[model samples]
Target: MKKIWEFIATGFYSGKLPKMPGTWGSIVAAIFLYFFWPENIVYQLLIVAVTFVSSVVSSQSLSEQLDDKDPDSVVIDEIIGMEIAMLGIKATLPVVVAALVIFRIIDIMKPPPIKLFEKLPGGFGITVDDMFAGLYSNILLRLLIWRHYV
Candidate 1:
């Protein structure tokens, strides 16, 4: 039970990486999700939902473990955010690449409301901020698709 809890909290050991584990975990999760779903809207939505819930719970546990506002190891937030960014998109290589780049940029920049969201309390703060970043990336991707693909 304890081990299971740890696995769940750490995103199956992705959070334990020595450096930038969260980023690595997110990238890995994105890749896994891309292959696993491959343009299936239902699967994509399921992934987004699962990631969102798991991230919130895991991030909260990680915060308690680290005794900090938002530890880098708490990267389930990034995983969830990236998954949301990829939602509703064809899992093509180009689309995936674009989403990754755009999401990374927006997440790192922490613009406006995204930055503001980070100020919220506890895990909610940690997860919501990244969720907003994901939302921003999703909107931008939609706009791009509409402008060119639609």
Candidate 2:
């Protein structure tokens, strides 16, 4: 059970990869969604919801077990965030690439309220910040898509 949580929290060990583990996690997530995402928006949202809860649970479990406030390797947050960024958006390569870039930028910069989410305790702290980044990316990507830029 703990092993399972560890796997989830680590984003299937994409988190352990050398250099930019979050990017690795995001790549894994983007690929997964590109291939396996549901046709319906509601179902896509359901998948994100389930993964969101799983992220909180698994990330908190791993954080407690490892005695880390926010481990670099706990990148399930990135997976969830990446999924959120692409939610209800078409999964074309250009769109995916644009969403990925935007998501990574917001996540790294942690602008405005996105940075504040890190103050929350435990896994909530670890995850919500990226969720906001993804949200920001989603909004920006939507605009870009609407303008036919992506």
Candidate 3:
């Protein structure tokens, strides 16, 4: 059913929060990552990879259904991006919160290659831009951790 697809594509309705739904989606994802992430980094990475692949597919479908190139109600991309940000990183309160903030900022700003990636067709357009934002946030968070900044 379309409702079922919408539910999954919306990241369990966090994307329907009416305002800053993307931020809400990222927060939920960070919480999920903190509480239930696999102890093994390999498995965590695998989950991120799987989430990314599946998000692309689901986002494309949802986009088509909504007749939009990138629907706000599709936040699987945010979840995937949050996972990318959390990858291989200890999910401490400070670290997780910082990653979430950084991800939100970068995702919102859409600087450089982040904007470029958003130009891709279909779900790749919807999902990859956030992925790059997550990658950027991850690198910054890693550096901050290395420097005891967060």
Candidate 4:
């Protein structure tokens, strides 16, 4: 059971990579977006919903196993966040790349409410901040798409 949660929390070991595990997880997630992103907005939303619940459970479990507040190796949050960032948008090369960069910046900077989100205990705290970062990215990309900038 622990191993199963570990696998999920670590993004199937993408988080085990040396240095910048979050970045690595996001990269893999971007690739996942490219290959697996749904065409319908409704389905895209469903995927995000499922990912959100699973990521929360897996991340929380792994955090308990490791006895850490936010384990460095748990990157499922980043993966799901990236998925959310790409929601309802066309998965073009430029869009995917932009989502990746924007999500990472917001995630790292942890601005405003995102910073506040980090205060929650357990996996909710660990994952919610990235969810906000992804929301920001999603909004920016949606605007750019609407304006024909992206």
* TM-score for each candidate, following the candidate numbering: 0.84, 0.96, 0.95, 0.95
- What is the lDDT ranking, best to worst? 4, 2, 3, 1
Error of 3 at 51 (Å): 0.7
Ranking by TM-score: 2, 4, 3, 1
lDDT of 2 by residue, 9-98 (tens): 998999999999898999888888778877689988998888889999999999999999998899999988988899898788888889
* Candidate 4 TM-score to native: 0.95
- For candidate 2, the 10 contiguous residues with the lowest summed lDDT are 30-39
Cα lDDT tens digits, model 1, 1-150, are: 445544765667787888867667677766866677557788678777777777677677767777888877667787777888878777666676677778888988999979998888877788898888889988998887778742
Model 4 residue 95 CA deviation (Å) reads 0.5
Runs off by more than 4 Å, candidate 2? none
Q: Over the stretch 1-150, how does candidate 4's per-residue lDDT look in tens digits?
A: 989989989999999999999999999999999888888999998988888888889999999998999999999999989998998887998899989998999899888989998889898988898999999989988887888877
What is the TM-score of candidate 1? 0.84
Cα lDDT of candidate 2 equals 0.90
Whole-model lDDT, model 1: 0.76
Tens digit of per-residue lDDT, candidate 3, span 66-114: 8999998889999988888888898888888899989999899988878
Off by over 4 Å in 3: none
Clashing pairs in 3: none
Please give the lDDT score at residue 116 for candidate 3.
89
